[model samples]
Target: MHPNKLRAFWAARQGLLECDTHLSPETVLEQTGWARSVGGVGPYLTLFTRAGLTRPAIDRAVAQLQIHELPSARGCTYVVPRSDFALALRCSQGFGDAAEVQTAKKHLGVTDAELDRLGRNVLDALAGGALDPAALKDRLGDLVRNLGPEGKKRGVTTTLPLVLGSLQTAGEIRRQPIGGRLDQQRYAYARWADSPLPEFTLDAAAADVELARHFFRWSGPASLAHFQAFSGLGVKASKAAVAPLGLLPVSADSPLLALPEDLDALRAFVPPETPVYRLVASVDALLLLRRDLALLLDPADVPRVQQIGGLQDLPSHAIVDRGRLVGLWEYDPEREDIAWTSFVRPDAALRAEVERTAAMIREHLGDARSFSLDSPESRKPRIAALRAG
Candidate 1:
């Protein structure tokens, strides 16, 4: 495949160019794959840009338990649809807790026995109803032990998070943004009345295979390296996980693999001739899932990529045309306008897209954060850099 054509193909597959009237947030997730939610607006923008889902609609879905953020593959939180919650939580099982547990044990003198006791306390506390972190901590009193200086140095701070994380991984409780919004990090804990882990029949290995299927279908023609990176399944497990999928290569010597059912469609797919502009979050699956931005760039843009930050990341939220990344964007809250710089010359279509997305952000989202710490003040440098371009 021609390089640009390949990029556009990825764009189409990501639901950027081929927008659809997906009836619900979960339906969009089912089609476009899970939206990465890093205490940011990526999930909302992803649903809006791809499925035309509004903020009110998405909030309603969350309020009604249609979709939610869950720790899944690689132990990263993704805004998952209701249908995949069990699969997501199942895949997350041992993966999410290993590192955190190890760090707590080594640095804060944490023990499995200590966590077991705290876990029970946490469950009992939430049995009555949900509680935000402060309230939960206050309710637990000294039961949620403070680790003092050593813990503070290592960023562990307290035993509360350790138990909370362990319990969440074990599916005893769920973390919800205080007001059920995806953008902020303040979370409340609630007992999952119908916890999926209890009913999830798939064991660890089977769950890994299921997640691998999702990875391929969402970002197919993706390399095995991509799957390994996303799953964090290490060498042998990652290979074993995808081995059952019967994935095929794009060419005789191609590194990329796709599901068997998708080969014909991949071959027949065509890049859009007219400019199809899309403004999306930095962590949108189109880039983050593959984590190989260099592959998405035109050869001419290589030097510019180096000048900015290189292939692994973008300096700001992406401005994509068809499937190819053409520019970078940031929302200027003061002006209530989108500030962007493009690899291609600024065109009417691109500006129009900026306006449309800006309008949506102003009226509905209020802001588009790259991650939890992102703010208007921090965005100035990137916006200035874009304006300078």
Candidate 2:
């Protein structure tokens, strides 16, 4: 398929094109895949850019148990809808404790029996009420054993993190931001009144198969390698996962795969004649899901990507037209404006989209930090580069 047509099909399927006013953030996430959350405003951008949802509405959904961040595929966190909570937790499995516990054992000689005991204590601490890490650690006292110098060197300062993580992935506890916002990471862990796992009936293999179903729907016309990478399921499990889904090739000689239901729709789809503009977060599913940057760019725009660096990844948040990337942008706090540079020549429509996104930032989402640690000082270089362009 032509790149123009290809991008539009992806954009519409990902809910980046014309949106209906009635759609909710939970519906947006269910229709598309979950929003990737990294203690940043990407989830806010993902919902607003697609469905015109406001920050308060998304935050309300978070508070009401309509959506939440959890350890999903690859043990990375994503803001998944309530309907998917069970599936997401099922996909996360052992990966939640894969690293920290192993390192603690290697460095501080921590044992599973010890960790198991600590997990119970952590749960007991939260049973009284939700508590931030500092407060919980204080309450945990001797139960939260310090790993000392050697453990700090290995990044396992205490037993608290290891147990808290294990309990969270196991669906016994949840982390909520203290401010009731999704854009920051200062969290209070609380015991779930109703855990998501007991309601999920699938076993391990069944969970993978179900995940493959969502994966292909979320990122069809994608490669087997793409699924493998997103899943982090390794070779044998990934093959087993997709096998039952009846994934098919777009053409006999083509290397791409698609869900059985999407092929006819993709064939019938047409790119809109007029540009449909949006400014999306760097981690938005449209870019991060299938992750083929060159395919989403026009040949004319290729140089703009090179101007920053190479196709390894985007240097900043993007300005998109019907899913094709037309520009790169970042928030400039000093000016209270969106700092942007376009790959295509700026037109009235494009400029309007930029200002609209800028004002939306000021009104609802606030800063556009890609992650929690990102700050205005750290963004100076990229802001300058966009200005230079």
What value does the lDDT take at residue 69 in candidate 1?
89
- Supply the TM-score for candidate 2: 0.97
TM-score of each: 0.97, 0.97
Once superposed on the true structure, which residue ranges of model 2 sit more than 4 Å away at CA?
none
Candidate 2 local lDDT, 18-105, one digit each (tens):
8665889899999889999888879999888878888889989999999999999888899999999989988888674667788888
Residues 134-207, candidate 1: write the lDDT tens digits: 99899888888888998888778888887887788777899988877889898999998888788889988898
Candidate 1 segments whose C-alpha is farther than 4 A from its true place: none
Residue 229's C-alpha lDDT in candidate 1?
A: 88
At residue 258, give the lDDT of candidate 1: 88
- What do the candidate models score in CA lDDT, each in turn? 0.86, 0.86
